[model samples]
Target: MYTIPKTSTTDMEVTSIRLEKELKDRLKKLANNKGYQALIRDILWTYVQQKSGDYQPQLSNSDIRASLPATAQQEERCVLTGKVIRPSEGMLLGLTNNGDMVPLSIDSLED
Candidate 1:
């Protein structure tokens, strides 16, 4: 699932967690225009989706810029077919037009 709907600051609860100074600096650099806290929320949402097996992305074959062969070091779901790519299984990394690299089952290309 995509990130939850955004709400105003008033709708959010205050929570605090400590981060290493170096990591905080790195997050700031990576955050850019989106702001670090928002980025952190997005990351949390993505992690939750993946763990829940609800992380399917809405992509199509035409959306792929290229397909590069690869082997899964860990389980992954093919973006197009939602098929599981078991560890050590040969798969393809579909580079999307938007630059995201996603997993694809080898058989996903057959049809």
Candidate 2:
């Protein structure tokens, strides 16, 4: 599973900014049917994540597992962490308590 870091915007105060009429029109067209505010929020969030080195490309368990060597796959350990995982452990990805995702074996994953 891919987790997107979220910051609560419920109590966020609204602020206004001015943009060129041409730029605003371009943004409106790029936003498709979504509200301009939402589009801007998403764009800013992605930028922040990239700048902070917090953006991680989401990959499926199969993709991660396939990248490992056959011996590692047969051992049922996380390719990144080399941590032994039991077959009953839940989650397809090797997620630590700190919420970092790592490559793990699909056979060891719990339903």
Candidate 3:
């Protein structure tokens, strides 16, 4: 007789997300034996994989530099914070939800 192997999910990091009560109920109804957590995790993993496959960071250094706004090129006020950053000061460029690249101060960003 062969025994089934147990799968381990212990190595995965746990995180919480807020969802609407109605949506939660709907997910629970559809989850059946898999449970809501597993269903949500599978959905998120699929989404991440799909999005990752679509992403291509092929921009050259000169292309990136040319894409920046005049203010960012001059290293003036930060796009997100509006705080003045000198040209010599260290700054980070981040992509916004609108797909536009914006300059930000390193201090304003979270790890």
Off by over 4 Å in 2: 1-10, 58-111
- Pairs with steric clashes in candidate 3: none
TM-score: model 2 vs. ground truth? 0.43
Deviation from native of the Cα of residue 26 in model 2, angstroms:
0.8
Candidate 2: Cα lDDT at 93: 48
Kindly list the per-residue Cα lDDT of model 1 for residues 1-111, writing each as its tens digit: 246788898999999999999988888898898798887887888777767887766577888889999999999988887788999999999988988898999988675
lDDT by residue (tens digit), candidate 2, 30-65: 778966766777777755654455554443344443
Using all chains and alpha carbons, the TM-scores for the candidates as numbered come to 0.75, 0.43, 0.41
Candidate No. with top TM-score: 1
What's the CA error at residue 82 for candidate 2, in Å? 20
What is each predicted model's overall lDDT from 0 to 1? 0.84, 0.53, 0.56
lDDT of 3 by residue, 18-52 (tens): 99999999999988997888778766754453345
RMSD per candidate (Å) reads 2.7, 11.7, 14.0
Q: Model 3, residue 30: displacement in angstroms?
A: 0.9
The per-candidate count of clashes, in order, stands at 0, 0, 0
Those runs of model 1 whose alpha carbons end farther than 4 Å from true positions after fitting are 58-63, 97-100, 107-111
